[model samples]
Target: MSAPLRVLIVDDERLARERLKDLLAEAGDMQLVGECRNGNEAIAAIDAERPDLVLLDVQMPGPDGFGVLRALPPESPPAVIFVTAHRDFAVQAFEANALDYLLKPFDRERFRQSLARARDRRKALASPLDTELLARLEALTRRPPHEPERYVTRLVARVGWRMRFLQVEDIDYLTAEGNYVSVQVGKQSHLTRETLSALEAKLDPKQFLRAHRSFIVRLDRIEEVEPLPPGEYVFVLRDGTRLTSGRSYRAQVQRALELPT
Candidate 1:
């Protein structure tokens, strides 16, 4: 007989966590091996138990679900189903190849659907740590953690709260910040959990334009580009916010914008 799928529940809310456990208990196909209330705890449980699936919450006290995901080795990806209260980050979650999402106030049927999908996908796969999986994740995440195919969906800002969710659409540009990438948004800039190269892959490139090694702009948000100096231009945003264009990205950005060279 096929081994029963093992699952780990990671959520900050006690009631939500217990409720999910109860839902799983009602079903006979999955075995709930462990439950955690925070990312830190979830990481420990994941490393020790190595569950087949993880029901991860996007928000938590510290080292949130994304942190727990980052903490794991890339080779051992546990199919993740995001349980989030915030709907704005849904696209990013799915972009990360999450099995499914259970918004708050989840019903039994929805839970079952998500669980079934995870199981079916798992059954169709042969091994987790194989090269094909690694390449797919690399193409998605741009880098492999100890667990390939996993990229951080949240950020631990350098000078603020321990956790924050900066959706991919919220990003206006990407700038290399040493080992990480600084994501520019409306008024506040956030440091992401992934490298610049990784963000390039994980992000929907059609929306984001890599203007420079240290700069990327949202294509739809650009208002105009004005010639400034030799092979240099000024990027005017939809909001009239302007930034200097990087030298290297001039031709490429021009090509994307369909501007005369």
Candidate 2:
């Protein structure tokens, strides 16, 4: 018979650690080697225990999950299944790289699925931290926790004969114009050859809001909001530009405005 997989659970919350311990106990083929409450402890535990798999939380004091991975030796890093509450771009990056990630509040079935995938990879002797994954972890670790994840502070726009750099804070709103996006600043509009959705991904969600399929307005620039029927609304900007919210973005708009849903 194959040996049981040794597992380490690393999370700041005691309840989260306990929950993982309970689940690990239910898996007969898995053995709980240790539990860590923070990133520093996790890093030390990883070195001391040398577990086969780590169920890691992203955010914690000192070094984060990314940091713990970063501290590991490049060769033969343990298999990882990130378990965190963050639903940020990093999660998407992890998915794109074909890494296992279990979002917080995951069900027992979901946990089983993630663990099974990890076991399969281990059996196959696949290297968990590849060049690309290491590069992504390096980038994520460099970002300041207070600032939004790699959000743009400025954007390049073409102005006839010259290239202009526009501060994101100065822009009032953005609207899609066919294959291009129009950056509206007061009365002047600068056209940039980029899709609205693509541009929106780089902007901070706290500062910019997608009001419709064709429009993205600065949250602070919104002077007033007029409610419309069927969970829709008309947002009046500081420059007197009125943009209607899309039906599909109702829940997001409500959350941004702190309105009763």
Tell me the whole-model lDDT of each prediction, alpha carbons only. 0.70, 0.77
Best by lDDT: 2
Residue 114, model 1: lDDT of: 93
What is the C-alpha lDDT profile of model 2 across 116-207, one tens digit per residue?
Answer: 87676554342223457444533443337676568877675655534466788899888774446778887666656567898899788999
**Which ten-residue region of model 1 has the weakest summed lDDT?**
154-163
TM-score of each: 0.50, 0.47
Q: Name the candidate that leads on TM-score.
A: 1
* Candidate 2 local Cα displacement, residue 218, angstroms: 38
The per-residue C-alpha lDDT of model 2 at residue 227 equals: 89
Candidate 1 C-alpha lDDT tens digits along 1-261: 678899999988889988998899987888999998888889888889989899999989889666676566544467899998888767556534466878888788998999888766554353223457444443452334566544444333332323354555566666664445666676555544456776676556667777766566788888888887777777887756555666888888788788888
Candidate 1: lDDT over CA atoms?
A: 0.70
